[model samples]
Each structure stands twice: as C-alpha cells, then as structure tokens.
Target: MEQHTVVLYGKPGCGPCVAVKAALERAGIEYVYVDVTTSPEGLEHVRELGYQHTPVIETSDDHWTDFRPDKLAALAKGLGS
Candidate 1:
C-alpha cells in the first residue's frame, strides 16, 4: 500500500485545491477532507511535511503539495503494498 489513508488538507477559497477534490471525486476515490482553516490538528498533521498551505494531500508514505497527480493516484490506491 502506498498510503494507509488519504487525507486532503484544504482551506476555503483555494481553486486548485477545489480542483483536486473534484478530481478525486471524479476518480471515485475515497478520502478524508480536512479544512485546515478550521482544524488545528489538520494543520499540524501537514506541518510535519513542511506544507504551509491548504490542500496538502497526504498518505502514510507521501505528501502532495499543490495537488500532484502521482499523489492523487497514491491517495486513490492507498497502501496496499
């Protein structure tokens, strides 16, 4: 498994983040969406990965800043290996 779980760290008014979410939805991916603007835990989680913005896509083994496609794939697939 490339990821144990998919966590999408997002904030309000982020267009790219929104696109990322939409892509995930369109791909039929299951993920946990967290609004960092409202959740300190969410911010702290991604902070460990050095991301200081919204929409930090994360898995057990990967962190996607700015919504990368590979990250999305890993998120959709998960840590099954």
Candidate 2:
C-alpha cells in the first residue's frame, strides 16, 4: 500500500495538542506538525477545515479535531507502512 501523509495542526500551550502529539509519538507514527500560532496559513487551513480547536489531525482519508486515540491508533496501524 502507498504510504499516506499525516499532518497535525496545532498551537502552542494547548493541552489537547500536547496530548495528541504525545499519543502520536507513542504510537510511532510519523507526521508533519504545523504550528498555527505562528503561521497565518496554518491557522487559515484549520479554519477552512471547519474547526475552531487546536490539535486538528489530517490524513489523506480523514480530518478531525482534538485528541482521538482510537482514530490515531487505527491510523498508525493502517497507514504506518
């Protein structure tokens, strides 16, 4: 299977974002981290996705807000190849 790119949009000093980052790290999943606090484009992208929260996760097939371990785990297992 082709490997999918994983992207995480977050801001500094956000608890949920921190937790999500930790979970992804523990799951051994490689991902691109975007700091919306510093990047206007990143913040715009998060808003365009219809989210008002930090820790927005985006995969080729899905996108969601906050920390979702189950989804993260599924992503790690299914797309970590």
Candidate 3:
C-alpha cells in the first residue's frame, strides 16, 4: 500500500470531529490532527477551502467536511490496494 497523508482540521468539542477521529482510528488510518481553534494557519486553510465548519478532512486526493463514514470507507479501500 502506498503511504498517504491525511490531515484533519477541527476545533475542540466538535461532535463530528470526534466521530471522524474515531472512524479514522477504527479504520487503522494514521492522520495528523490540527486544532483549528489554536492553529491560525489551519483555520485559514480551511476557510480558503470554502468550508465554514470544523472536521474538515483532507486526504492525498480529496477533501471533505463533516463526519462521512462512506468517504472513510472509500479511503480505506483505496489505501488497501
């Protein structure tokens, strides 16, 4: 499997963010967590992406907002190959 980087930009106390983190962990996917509340750059990057919410997930080939199990499944499947 080719190594891919996943970055999760989220703030504290976000329910979806917590779910996304748990889903990624359950999928055995390693990811870097950026607290947007503390990281100015991360907040700027998420805003630049046109998202006004937390739990912004960015993979090597795609990016999305909110807790999406289907997307996480696809990411796992892609990484498995």
- lDDT tens digits, residues 4-77, model 1? 66778998999889989998887787778999889888888879879888778776676778968776666565
CA RMSD of all predictions? 3.3, 2.4, 2.5
lDDT of all predictions, in order shown? Answer: 0.78, 0.87, 0.91
Tell me model 2's lDDT, rounded to 2 decimals: 0.87
Show model 1 residue runs off by greater than 4 Å. Answer: 1-3, 74-81
The per-candidate count of clashes, in order, stands at: 6, 0, 0
Ranking by lDDT: 3, 2, 1
Which consecutive 10 residues in model 3 have the weakest lDDT in total?
1-10
Candidate 2 C-alpha lDDT tens digits along 7-69: 899987999999998888888888899999888998999999999989899988889998888
What's the TM-score of every candidate structure?
0.79, 0.90, 0.93
lDDT of 3: 0.91
| Decoy 1 TM-score against native | 0.79
Of 1 and 3, the candidate ahead on lDDT is 3
Best by TM-score: 3
lDDT (0-100) at residue 51 of candidate 2? 94
Model 3 lDDT per residue over 1-81, tens place: 134999999998899999999999989988999999999999999999899998999987889999998999999888782
Worst 10 residues of 2 by lDDT: 1-10
